[model samples]
Target: MRPFAYERAATAEDALRRHAAGDGAVAYLGGGTNLVDLMRLGVAMPARLVDVARLPYDRIEHRADGGLVIGAAVRNSDLAADLGVRADHPLLSQALLSGASGQIRNQATVGGNLLQRTRCPYFQDISKACNKRDPGSGCPAIEGDHENLAILDHSPECVATHPSDMAVALAALDARVRVRQPDGEDVVPLERLYRSPGDDPSRDTTLAPGDLITGVEVPAPLRMPARYRKVRERASFAFALVSVAAALDVSGGSVRDCRIALGGVAPRPWRAHRAEDALRGRPATPGSFRAAAEAELAAADPLPGNAYKVPLAVNLVAAVLTDLAGEAS
Candidate 1:
């Protein structure tokens, strides 16, 4: 790792100020789970580190509207174990538990997890040409080792996929990301926080350079059965090949409302809006689930090696919705 100046900020304002003053490649240190690993791999070369781990953004507050506001600094494990979260947003809890091992979950913060970088191998190898790591550079993953890459909404410039299980749940729950900008604070929908690679793969999120993520606000609880299912190469400590986070509200043998978001298949959390539209007011049957999943996946443009993901996603979505529907009954 390169030598860098390190400072701990007691407040968000101080952290932003320090970040703004830094000459080059300034990064906020949260759990040091992702950023430190990137530094070690020479993929990230920040000139200065501002430790935001000590900031007072570690609480989980219940809102009067029956929602919850999760502080950015709250550890992943703590968030998953929170009684309110497990009871109200079981999907989020399940997604967190399905992610990295206990050690990593203990160190990874909610904000950090949302902002974590892609696990693309090419992006991590400094010697290789990765458009996400270096703008204008060619993306080798387009033709090499792309089986685990994106299958939807990927640009020619980048095929990498976001690797956050928690973000997938947030997307399904229609959460808002709270950020502290230099001029003022802003609340952005979690879905809007991420951007497709498009022509500039160097940028991972829509957040401005100095914007600090403060917390996330989930709207009123679904009050419906939900599930987060992941399929990976191993039982644990592995990234998802395809994952689904789904919530369903069924009434009288029909679907009243539903939300589905996919991971390991897109640059951002792939909110299955098309599927939701198809499933709403429809019979909660295996056939209906399959059609909805297909409707959402019809837009997928998978590479030759990853075409299997389409069927995998289809089956997973159907199974999760069917299981949830059965439980609802």
Candidate 2:
């Protein structure tokens, strides 16, 4: 086993200091949901751990701007049960409920969920050839059991999808992520936080290694009707096969505005740009939904085993829009 140093921070600033002094080789400790497992598997060999567990950023607050303010360390379980958040943003509550079990939810943090590694088996096994784990190593999933992997926004180097159900909901709401870099703290729009894996799959996020997510700010809801739909192999304990989050407001039987995002079939929580573009200022009908889903999926690049996801996701998008349109509430 590789040896490492551990330092606990008294404040948020101290955590940043420990991370920067190590030249970005430091890992910020969250609820240890994914990180602890990676360390045991030898997938991550950080030289130091900056434990930010003691920081006072674990509370979930509602902003006066009519938005949700989730601290970086807020537990998944707590976030899911917050009355205000659930009543206003059902998409978020639904995502959290669909994630891991109750025990795991109590231990996972929103900040860590945003930064969790891919669920690709090859990437977790060091002996296997995985581009995401070792930059130059060829991707084994290119010819392996990629049925459970990504089908959209994939490049030659990688097809691993981001694995957070909550993230998909957040993306649809156009949330903002706060990061405490080695130098200072700043906020980044959620849509730009993840990068597509082109030739380099080893780099997973835009967060420089030492940078830690400090909090997430969900903007005020557009007052448009919104909902989330998730389908999985199991009802209670599984990741989505094809999930969708949407916010729509129809004016005079036409779509005046909409926000769409997809999960479980993309490199990131895919903001359906094609669908979003196709949806705005159009008639709210099943035909238009089909056209929109097809337009967005046109750019998807699927692997040999996961091609079925394309049609599955397309159908799901159409169904979700139809259900949401029929709802009177």
lDDT tens per residue, model 1, 1-329 = 99999999988999999999996589999998999999999998999999998899999998887699999999999999999899889999999999999999999999999999999999999999999998888999989989999999999999999999999999999999999999989999999999999999888899999799999999988999999999999998899999999999999999999999999999999899999999999999999999999999999999998999999999999999999999999
TM-score of 2: 0.96
lDDT of predicted model 1 = 0.95
Off by over 4 Å in 1: none
Off by over 4 Å in 2: none
Worst 10 residues of 1 by lDDT: 62-71
Q: What are the lDDT scores of the predictions, listed in order?
A: 0.95, 0.86
Cα misplacement distance, residue 1 of candidate 2 (Å) = 4.6
lDDT of 2 at 135: 86
- Model 1, residue 118: what's the lDDT? 97
RMSD of each: 0.7, 1.5
Clashes of each: 0, 0
